[model samples]
Target: MNEAAGDGSSFSSKVIGIVFIILLLDLLGFTLILPLLPSILDHYAQAGDVTYQSLQSVVDWFRKAVGIPMEKKYNSVLFGGLIGSLFSLLQFLSSPVTGALSDRHGRRPLLILTTVGLAASYAVWAVSRSFIMFLLFRVIGGICKGNVSLCTAIVADLPCPKARNRGMAMIGVAFSLGFTVGPLMGAYFAVSSKTTGNVFYETPALLALTFSVIDIFVIWMMLPETLPKVIKGSSSHGGDSMDLLSPVSLFHFTAVTRTKEPPSKERMQKLQVLGLVYFCYLFLFSGLEFTLSFLTHQRFKFTSMQQGKMFFFVGVIMALIQGGYARRIKPGQHIRAVYMAIMMLIPAFILIGLSWNIAMLYIGLALYSFAAAIVVPCLSTLVADHGSANQKGTVMGILRSLGALARAFGPVVSSSVYWIAGAQTCFLITSASFVIPLFLLSKAQRSKEE
Candidate 1:
């Protein structure tokens, strides 16, 4: 029995290790493309393709209605924002369903399937010759984007919240590493392609595909089913009752609340409040984040390589904070930590918005990276504490879904504001808007205390 216990511990360690490595690789692929998006859009636009012209016309009409200047750069940024929103929208639609399905079936199989789908998306991207084909690639990638939430659920399946918090921190580290290395590689390829006068983006696409394929194989070979069979059987209605198409049920997490053995009403309310807080936070954050590339390009004339270097800086700072500071945060102390992180962002964005030089920008980015490192991972840890063992997947899924929903609309709205009102105004307004989520989070905490 002692030997068996040791074996179980070993297996859990191995599983967590694999999860970390896989996420690191997957994020590397995901971030690799982010820095290149604006360039890709410009490529198609310059080609005078039908798809680009059609989209540009709609964007131009909107700009005219808003009385903004008719600059082509604005069109590309707005266009990129739309594409980013589309990806998030698909993720919003699919994440919960994927989570619910994983709950009903198991994590291993779902991981394999979704990873395969992601690989196929990258495959399409590798051969894409037109805006339409690239759009299809985003569609496919977004639909298969449930792997992150599933990994979170797996962490939640751990024996205790403390262990889960550490796991969440590990995941954050994976994100940090991925973001750090991916953009640099992307920038390198972009520079190389530009020098060669052929910028089709096949190399990065192929690299992403390779990572996805390796992830699929790793999950298939190594990841044990973290969800117990007893828990699996009970999740039969995991997310079945929640209307996938409806925002009402998805935000409220009816999938978890409506379960055969639901959490208490108070718990449900707390979860719902938490979900809203996450949505509001990401809604504000993602908008600014998605536009950062355009902001640097327009303000500082940052080339692809410069943009890559900028992200590398952010990623490194985020990783260090997650590893050195965030992981050490006590389990029940996450709410306090989250408060501190949220407070940090208010000034971070202000500095960023007001920056007249790279020094001020980096200062803001440092604060931004620190806050980013702490908040989401801490929130994930806190949320995991609320769910029962069986409801882990549904709970994590709904949270991710809410975040996805925020991401879907955040970029479009923020980008529109960006083009019309200018980056400084957009950043200032959004920075102040962070208060909304902070207030909501405080309310949730008070309710939890009550």
Candidate 2:
């Protein structure tokens, strides 16, 4: 029995490591394409002088071979952005359903299925020859990928109440690390492709596909089933034996018999307040995403690579703050709130709105990113603290989906604002939106103590 316990510990560690590695690789692959997007579109649009007549001739020949219409080249970039947005939209749609499903069917199967789907999506992107094919692959990829939900469920399966906060913080760290490395690698690959005069679009796609394949293999070979089986003998004691399809009924049943802890109306109120806080948080976040890209492009005339580097900086600051400070800060301590408040007042976006140069832009961005990192992890931990173990995935999924919904409208909203008023006005509006969440968070904190 001791030997078996030891073996199980080893297996669990291995599975966790593999999951982390796969996430890193998947993120890296996505980042690689991002920096090159603008350039690739510009290339087909004939935006640059022919630095190499030979390369230009080859590009022309390839365009003709692919039967890309002359007028469609510039429009392809917009279509690509739409495809990517659609992918996120699909994720928003599927995540809660996937999380709820994992609650019933188990995390391991969903993880495997989603990983396989992600790989196939990458393959589709890698070999895509036309805008239609690209869009099709993006949609399919979005439908299949549920990494965030699956990972949240896995964390729920493993962590105890005391350790749950740390677990969530670690997940945030993993995200930051992935964001940091993925874009840097993508930029490097994009630069290399430019030198070789081959189309850069496919390189990142192929690299991402390869990583996904690796992820699939790692999961199949290294990961063990984490889901506990319901024993027939335990049914009399109120084990998980009910049909999972009826989630509402299952939740009600579980609430009734799964544990001895009585439901607290206060706890429910705290959760409601936390959920509102998260909703406001996501609203501001979506606005930032929409505003950042356009602001950088219009104000600094920054290239995609530059934009990616800015993202890399954000990732670095986020990882450091969340990994280093979030867990260490005492719960219910006023220090957390004070720190958050100070960070929020950094005037990053305000600076960005007024920046005349890249240096100032970077400084502003860094301040904003640092504040975001600190606040987001704290919010995540707060949610986890307020939720039951069985409901963690659902809560996280709901939070993420709300953020996605915000993001879905963000681009259009920002674009419209920029068109009508300008980038400065857009940023100013977004900056003010942050205040709404700050107020809500304060309310949440007060409610929690009460």
Candidate 3:
């Protein structure tokens, strides 16, 4: 029995190691386009493609409706925000369904399916010659991006909260490494294309496709079905009941209870509160994050290479914090760490908003990266601890879906604010908005205590 237990433990460890690599590769591909969004949009606009013009006309109408100006700088930023929001909106629609399906079928198959879909999306992107083609790429990519949520569910499947926390931290580290390296690679391609006169944006897209193919093969070969067969059979009925279109059903994880073993009221409340906190926080954070490249380009005239360097700095800081601090957080300490991280965001955004020079921006980003590194992992750990074994995938999916919803709207709203009011105002408002989630988090903690 002892030897058998040891083998199982060893296998779980191996699973986690592979999960880390998959996430790293997945995110590496996903983020390669981040630093290039502004340039890409500009290229489409200048190409005068019929689809680009059609979209531009609608944007023009919206600007007229809202009295936003026709400044070229703001135009690209707005387009970028729209593209970002579209990608996230698809994610919002798909995450819960994917999560519920994974609950029924198992994680390994879902991972493989999603990775394959992602590879197809990248292939489309590599050959995209028009704006509509690129838009289709985003659509497919977003629908398949539920891999991250599935990855988190895998962590929650581990034996204990401590193990789950460490696993979440590893996810964070993967994100850090991906973001750190991906943009740099993209920027290099961008520069090379300028000199080589290669097809614009083809190289980065091809590279992302390469990563997706590798990820698919890895999961097929190495990732065991983390969700057990018994759980899969039991949850099969509830899977079909998941209503993707109903926000209420999604947030409440209604399908999770169909198995006749609902979570306790207390646990349900905790999940609700955590989901809200995640949504609220990401709503604000993602908008600012999505716009950062545009802000730097407009304010500081940062080229693609410079934007890559900036993300590299942020990614390095985040990886260090996750590897050194976040992974070690004890079970009960998650809430406190969450509190501290959210509080840090207040100053971080303020400093970023107030930045006139690069030094001030980097200083704020240091704090931002620290907070970003810890909060999601800690919150995920807390949520994982609260979820019953059968409902882990559903719960994590609900949380990620909420985040996707926030991200879908956040960029559009923030970019509108940035376009009409300006970046300083947008940043200042977002800084103050952090209080909403913090207040909600504190209330949740108090209820948990009581």
Candidate 4:
């Protein structure tokens, strides 16, 4: 809320639009690989790659030890979650470094560096022959996943604090559209080769690589450095910034609501509270998202195509909200929007956990999807409004990096719980997790009043 407003320091609409494209393309590359990687493993296994040799050995041992069959599709789904967790883990480790680097240097150079690296990683993926080679590409891709955080930081830097959510909504629209189309495109390429007995496995990666190349060009040409001259040299700590390496520093919510700065107490507390609440919410939501396919398969026997359709539907709803409704909502109303969305989570979880029919399942999905769509821009607006000018990149990165950390661990833990307990129990526990955020949100309100 302490953001300074002026036209002279504002970013151009063109730069924001380009940032949107960059985020879209980044998600596009990710989604392209996500749905298909498990199936791709079958190819790698058949090829007798040493990595596949090791992985198949583990899979065989697990099946034998547990006396349970891990069918091709089931194995694909489980391995897919593990792979996603790995990517998120890498993103968590790298995001703060990227954000801090952006602060010390500038956003544009970091954006360009990551974008180009991502494109090259995709290129490696396209040409990959062995399972180790594929993992290598994924490792590189994970390291470059800091673009979105940097782009969010870039959006936060624009002149008007209140309008930051609108910019984030535009980025969200790009994300929705990418989510809608990327997997479909990857599927299309994948299906063309799926019937060939593992001969056409590279098609999807090749296409994703192509899109990444375009992203790199766009970043180099149109994206401007949004870091203002005044803020460029603000971070004076030189070699091996100690705070950057400190785990305590990483977990301090939003940089110590404990800071003794007289003028910053309220602002820091708002961010600290919101950041913690949002991180918990994201962790639960991600767990639900990852485990849903298992739930549907058990309850409805849904195929891969059917699951893809479900995600496509969620993406459409998000795109509509972010592009239309979200942009129209006034700044003062963002908190109300966040609260309304949070309330929807209760019924969303209950309906999902208790659903016995397709109608109930989709209805639950719709409610949850709508809630998530609205929350993203609202949270973005809140963080940007409160972030210190010199520390925006670091703050934004830490906020999102924690979410990345949750996403990394959420899937594995959720899936393990689902197996040990059951879908209903898992959903109910996730629903109970909402109590933390609700309590935090109430505290935020009281703090503001005080």
Candidate 5:
């Protein structure tokens, strides 16, 4: 394929390194804002004296705009997630279009655009004085940030099949590392800000915004244009015909069209099975976000710092499993391991629901994180293996869209469950949700053997 161009070792290394850095920066900006949100809302709600009146007015305005109940200050977290889900929805909507754009307009502009959008989002969040303003900024950020799609595209462009899994695993590693480090940074900011008693200064949103600016600068200076230009007057014949700028016409170009084996009935069945598995995986994954945040607040009465630290530990476990062990396993075995890991999540969720203190929560989080790390890389590898090279971008785009859809509903479901049955019941229901997928995966395995 394409004469296997470039020094394989160096090329592999560079791809992984660049992607890892990109994911790290992207996730770091994300995680830094999460833990501090509930605290920020509570802080503003409980302010004293003259400042309290202003803060109260801001909170009241937010509640009215978002339709959140006035009794619950922590509803801020739910609203924040709702806002984030809107962003996820935007990502879901744009993924296919963006993937197609990358195919047409090339990857460089999209990448640059995503970075700039993220930076702008952070800037909006940092300076936001009201909840409505915050939500508006988050939506803008969501519309702009397409890091997941872009990173996947980068992997598609640079790596071969055999090395692709490893390349993706490195992306997972970057996510885990960012997960680990970002919250710690956020926690530090929150604690220092708490100690100083400066309302505006301690905001995690501002910290996230600063990192985004740095990321923008890094990308602008260091990242190269990965899309090559079509040679003038060079076609499959003697004529020059490719139009790079026309999004619609670019599909007709030879670069976008390549022959591949059609999907057999059997392959279609397998894909259906995998798609089901992914749907369930994302549902459970989204539920965990709610469970963790709710449980942290309920069981240990954790401060923002404590919550951030717990996530940092979860990130560590994920980094270890994804980075250290993913490549050691074969593809089939990796999938099987991931299935077992999903099963393991039952106990982890149960433990989290039952956790009486921070220590127990940490233990549960670690187990959950390790299981998650295994599942993500394995599922991604499976999708890549099942897809043809020509349709890889499209298939991945669909998968990401499904994930975004799941994320959109996940928080809403989790919040509803928490409200109805309480934290323990919410975890129990989520635990039960894992079982359906495990059974489906088993059935798929049996069908495959046949």
Candidate 6:
């Protein structure tokens, strides 16, 4: 019996490892296109290009409605912003369904199916020529990668509550590395293509496709059901019965399960506060992230390669802090650390908004990366600590959805602000954007104390 138990533990650990690696690959495949977005949009923004007319048509609509000045920058920001936001929008719409289905069916099948779908999207991306087809690829990829929360749900399902934090940290490590490596390789492939008469322009997509195929194999061979059906869909709240196909269900977690016993007044308030905090924090940061490229390119004349390197450095810092220093944070102590990190971002955004030199930009980005690293895992573990075990998966899924929803809107708003108000104004606004969350956090703290 002892030997059998040990073997079972080993198997579980192996499965967890693959999930971590696959999660890493999923993030990597997505971020691989980050450094290339500006160039790609510019590529199709010309008069004779296939995507130009359709893209410019949208830009013209925005101009008429908002009275924003019209220029090539309008087309560029719209294209990139739309592509980025669409991906997140789909994730917002699909996350809980992915989570709920995994809860009802089993993690193994959902995980495998999502992986296969992602691989298929990459295949389409590799062959894409026109802007419309590439946009189609983005939509397909968004639908495929909406499994972001299922990974968290699995971590929450861990038998040991403490283990969930460690697990989320490990996932964070992978997440950090994915951002670190993806753009670096993307920029390299893009720069290399220039020397080869521009044939390698499609190289980034091909490489992302290759990674997706490999991820599919690893997931197929190794992963087991993280969430078993027996414990999958039981509602602590009454039987709310979520239909993933319903449009209304997309916005509400209640679509997943009804309440048998509604949560306490305190839990409801905490979740509400946390949801607001999560949405606001991600919204500001993602806006900062989405517009950073424009700011750098305009202010410092950065190439795609330089931009990729900057992102790489940020990822390095993030991985180190999340994987190493974050472990030292004890369980109930996460709030203090979260408060500090949230404050750090204010000055960081200011530096990015005002940076006109390489040194200043890198310094600001390093600070930004550190705050992000701390907030992600700490927030996940902190929120996971609340709520009943039976309902934890749904809670985490909802949290991920909130973050995704914020990201969906972040880029569009930030880009428009940047276009209208200038980079400095845009960054300054984002810097002050934390005020809402800070206020919410203080109220939550007082409520907890009371």
- Taking the tens digit of each residue's C-alpha lDDT, what string does model 3 give over 1-450? 011122256766776898999999999999889888888988888889899898888888988897766776788877888888999989988888888888878888888999999999999999998899999999999999988999999888876545566678888899889989999898888788768887658899999999999999899887777776667756646345445547787667566566557777877777778888888989999977998999998898999999999999999999999888888887677778888998898888888888999999999999999988988878877777665677788778878888899999999999988888888999999999999999988888887532
Better of 1 and 5 by lDDT: 1
Candidate 4 minimal-lDDT segment of 10 residues: 254-263
Question: Please, what are the lDDT tens digits per residue for candidate 1 over residues 332-430?
Answer: 677788888989999999898888999999999999999889888888887777768788887888888889999999999999888888889989999
Estimate, for each residue in 34-150, the C-alpha lDDT of model 5 and write its tens digit.
677566556554653354355456757866886656555245445545655787777666665565565445555777787788877777776766666666676887677677766
Cα lDDT tens digits, model 2, 32-72, are: 66555555545544643333233445545655786755533
- Any residue pairs clashing in model 6, and if so which? 237-258, 237-259, 237-260, 238-258, 238-259, 238-260, 240-258, 242-255
Angstrom error of the Cα, residue 355, model 1: value is: 1.3
Question: lDDT tens string, model 6, 316-429?
Answer: 999899877887788767777878899999999999889878889888998899898888777787667655545555667677777878889999888877777778898998
Off by over 4 Å in 1: 1-8, 194-200, 236-241
Q: Which candidate, 4 or 5, would have the higher lDDT against the true structure?
A: 4
RMSD of 1: 2.3
Candidate 4 residue pairs that clash? none
**By lDDT, highest first, what's the ranking?**
3, 1, 6, 4, 5, 2
Where is model 2 more than 4 Å wrong at Cα?
A: 1-16, 40-85, 231-263, 333-346, 448-450
**True-structure RMSD, every candidate:** 2.3, 8.1, 2.3, 4.0, 6.4, 3.2
Best of the two (2, 4) by lDDT: 4
The local distance difference test score of model 6 is: 0.74
Instruction: Choose 1 or 2, whichever is better by TM-score.
Output: 1
Counting clashing residue pairs in each candidate, in order, gives 0, 1, 0, 0, 0, 8
Off by over 4 Å in 4: 1-11, 41-78, 195-201, 238-242, 245-247, 253-263, 294-303, 353-356
Which digits, one per residue and each the tens of the lDDT, describe model 4 over residues 193-239?
A: 66765545477787778888888888887777778766765764544
Worst lDDT 10-window in candidate 1: 1-10
Deviation (Å) of 74 in candidate 6: 4.4
The per-residue C-alpha lDDT of model 4 at residue 391 equals 71
lDDT of each: 0.84, 0.60, 0.84, 0.73, 0.66, 0.74
Candidate 6, after superposition: displacement of residue 46 in Å? 3.6
